[model samples]
Target: MSSNRVTPTEAWQATASRAADCALFFDFDGVLSPITDDPEASQPVPEVLEALDALSRLVRRVAIVSARPVDFLRARFGTLSEVDLFGLYGLERSHGKGETVTEPAALPWVPVVEEVASEARTALGDKAYVEFKRLSVALHWRKTPEHAAEIESWAHAEAERRGLKVQLGRKVIELKPPVDRDKGFVISEAVLSVGCAWYFGDDVSDIKAFDALRARTAVEPGFLGVCVAVASSDETGQEVSDAADFTIESPVAVGTFLADAVKILQANAAS
Candidate 1:
């Protein structure tokens, strides 16, 4: 926290030393796979898949937290005994090999989310696409950047009207049910208990997860929490980079970092 940013190698080395109590968390888009305009086309790099397969052997926990639906994530990564999937920003979760669980509190808001999704589709018309999920509705303007501001304003108005929370991400605006959960809550309450936690993320919403780790470290100063921002040197991701303890330029670098983590943990085990 004192220094600006540590090199990826330093993070990997430190993680290796704390392997017994280490947990790795990742954000899917732009962290595991390259950000694509066609979200359906996004796929994890082979190196990332290999690294995760290896980490399953080394770590106590590996959690992928994302705004994607749990079903979509399950289809992409399959079920792993050591991996937990926190989807819809933790509104929905799937434990290793278990069925996806929706928070009971979030269920009542399903109709509300559907209504908003309908409004988004009508308002944005052809300029944007509405992504309907269990507890949230997202209006994505990735393919229509010129309509970004208009779509965002409408999404915000709808969220405000419905007493929903607005989640801002890259070229997307989401209306989430007014739940007390987020990436931060999920990490603190459900995932990260006894570990030197490492989280890699690439969007604005990921700051809350980083904040959760920082709060824990503040109470127990010996706690090692590494926040890795996967972002380009571009201005768009500066906020994410600034909030993180370390930075990796792209998803490719993220794959390399994870692979390095696997090797380091494997080496430590052999020793």
Candidate 2:
């Protein structure tokens, strides 16, 4: 809602008008689906699928960069086509044909993550909750605010012991493999391979992608890229919005924005 920031609707319109040579990136959890207590339970808004289908036809490339595992995301959106999917915060990339590219060094981290989850469950006891992601383990302190400090300490200690990295967002802390790759790195690589790019995200983790876009624009004129945040009354959402070029009210708004972008691109193409 800053003076210089655009609304999701307006940003989508601008993106659609210049769809050619554009690469679109999306964050799955909060941007495509409403965040839930159980991350695995998150489901994309119905319209998002339709809009992605349309947008794929308009843009040069569309990719999803998420912290979820590639296999999980593929299973979730198995029917969609022409949209590239990157999971584990871009540590893994997969296409529709089931071909997957992953950092070989990070492959061993899966079992490490599982071990951490077990450790968290044992360490936290009944005070905190653990969500086991294939590539990472998230410790949720939403239901145990009194144990936030303890949870953070445990997460840090476990990550250090495993020689991994920790990412803090909202009321959750995640342990990811120690790699120099992230959504930003993925976006930058994608742009180099493709061209202009745009990104939509809804959490602090997505800030990396936003920063990447800003950095790219500074070096290249008319980059035709923007970062959008899906705003919510939560710390993670606020952090993401602060770094974004535009903010949408909710997941529903995000779907509407995507749908509008597809319409604009289609209309422009027809004209």
Candidate 3:
């Protein structure tokens, strides 16, 4: 772990004291579940969601912020009253798992994004299908890792041509509207009501959330803001780890951390 990050013991110590007032934020893929080549195939670890259900009963708030769409998120998470799923970063939000609110500012970009997805599918064929997202398009090359560079380059050029933004992730490249919204915005908005905010994530987009936590902690010196990186075997995890205040080994470790957190929170509540 880097000097900036606390060990698990230290993280527990720091969080335990403030658990009652803390808000927990997590990224979906790679954090709650392992990444899948088919985004549609990704599902939360059963233990993970069950742990979240347990923790949510004790915590002030629990949120899952991710690049996945709200519909997919709602389907997988399924009416978990304790969790808020913010999809496509902050462009859409599902509160109490009831209804998702899509930002109106993002509405105008839908047609353009759809057009980009269509073009990408026609050009890349089955290799990069499922390019149509109302707010973004993703070209997954997880199965074809050898073509990563090729796909990335092409995606970048296409994004530039179409005035869109591209995000790099594990075995995937996403082209989204060039909106100001991101995981950072979601965290920044979330931290205002909570005393201590902890965010766990595992990708380039999560870096924005880490930076937000770091920034909010600076101004609100009393805020216990923690950034946890749920890493994979790849280098992408290293980048996320470098920016994190703590790092967990893998999604399984995230479950362990969450379980421990639940115990600590419950213990503190009892005491």
Where's the lowest-lDDT run of ten residues in candidate 3?
1-10
The lDDT of model 1 is 0.82
Ranking by TM-score: 1, 3, 2
List model 2 lDDT by residue over 1-271, tens digit each: 2228566556656666667788889988877888777666888899988888778888888788888888888877778778889988888888854788888888888898888889888989988878887678888887788999999998898888889899987788889889888887888778775447888888777888888887787787667668778874465545677787767777788788777777777887888
| lDDT for each residue of candidate 1 in 1-271, tens digit (9 for 90 to 100) | 5234567677667777777787888999888988887887888877888889789778777889999988888877884666889999888889766889998999999999988888777878988988888689888888899999899888888888999999888888889998998888877774346658888888888999999889888888877888888883253377888898877888888778778778788888898
Q: Which ten residues in a row have the lowest lDDT in candidate 1?
A: 1-10
Query: Which pairs in model 1 have colliding backbones?
Result: none
lDDT of each: 0.82, 0.80, 0.81
Q: If scored against the real structure, what TM-score would every candidate get?
A: 0.94, 0.91, 0.93
- For model 1, what is the alpha-carbon lDDT of residue 195? 59
- lDDT, candidate 3, 186-216, per-residue tens: 9998898888888888888899998888888
TM-score of 3: 0.93
TM-score of 1: 0.94
- Sequence-dependent TM-score of model 2: 0.91
